[model samples]
Target: MARVVWHVPVTTSGPGSTTALRLFRLRDGRRCAVGFSSPAALAALLGPDQAHTELGEPALHALTTPLGVDVLVLDPRLVAPPVTAPATPAAPAPTALLQHR
Candidate 1:
């Protein structure tokens, strides 16, 4: 039987570029970024494979909906972060004025 995989977040320290969020999976305590996708809101649980970082057309519609039969397991850690009030924009810099004697 295939080992159960747990979903994880792609925090700052996690691998993968900002263009696509890093999809992590914890199998038997070992964490690895299995894939990356921008459109896919949720990460899919695949049998431990390296993530595809290439910036190209996504052949697969969604991570969970692969080409054929797939196993997807959910974890509690995949919760949306708490919403916080937006920060106020900084004030513009002062303009320089020249004085002639």
Candidate 2:
């Protein structure tokens, strides 16, 4: 079965945050870009909290901000996928670890 499309809602407030909570979803393993692009339009999206940021990038999502990194990153809340979940009762970590060592 095809993997389910994961939808993420990103809300930012405080310095460099959006004035209102905005939602963005992942598409084809990449973030689907938002369309609100004018400098004034972008500014309106940010309340006093994010007023200090300079408006750049016309095609930016309303809820995203650079976190000292030039590239986008996966949200920290995303845990290792189900495939990486704890081993089943049939298989345990200690047995595997001892076998390899």
Candidate 3:
């Protein structure tokens, strides 16, 4: 089976918490769970209404409803490092006298 990855930032509502929901294709097929840092975070990301439904549902109807693929929550460590540039100090604004008034 091919391995695909999905990434989403956690919401402020659910901090320092994580959750995982598993999905299976076949009765014995490899199952995978999609994890969120927190329920509030997951809810914030997926929307409050959907979050409630997602937790209650067994197979996560939304995932299969849109596509036949399962939803899996992976560890944050598994995610790729963010691509960013080093922060640089801002240059001081030119003095008013230096401006061409």
Candidate 4:
């Protein structure tokens, strides 16, 4: 069976105050770590007195709809497009008369 990986963002308040939580889950009950960010601005995006919690599969499925978290699907063979080099003007061909001078 093909595995599907999902990137979920979670928010919690603690020592660092603000953080980007990354949750990865596969189709066959397998999971792995992806990545996260520690941007303070993320706090503003959250509402006041909002409760945050991380629950396992059981609790996660209990919810009828998505909560505060944003889910993103990730491709296993992720690769960034190659950056092309800037074009440089070719040097003008040297003229025979100019070369002789």
TM-scores for the candidates = 0.22, 0.20, 0.26, 0.24
Candidate 3: 10-residue stretch with minimal lDDT: 50-59
The local distance difference test score of model 2 is: 0.36
lDDT of 3 by residue, 1-34 (tens): 5433233332234655654333323345644445
How far out, in Å, is residue 20 in model 2? 3.8
lDDT string, candidate 1, 1-101, tens digits: 54333332333435543534344345445333333333132334222342333322222225434433133333323444689876987678998999999
Candidate 3 lDDT score at position 79: 36
The lDDT-based order of candidates, best leading, equals: 3, 4, 1, 2
Please give the range of 10 consecutive residues that has the lowest summed lDDT in model 4: 34-43
Deviation in Å, model 3, residue 74 alpha carbon: 6.3
Assess candidate 1 and give its lDDT. 0.38
Q: What is the lDDT of residue 3 in candidate 2?
A: 31
Tens digits of per-residue lDDT for model 4, 1-101: 54332222465667778654445554554453332122222233333333334334334433412543333332233344679876997788987664553
lDDT of each: 0.38, 0.36, 0.44, 0.40
Residue 73 miss distance in model 3 (angstroms):
2.2
Alpha-carbon deviation at 4 in model 2, angstroms: 29
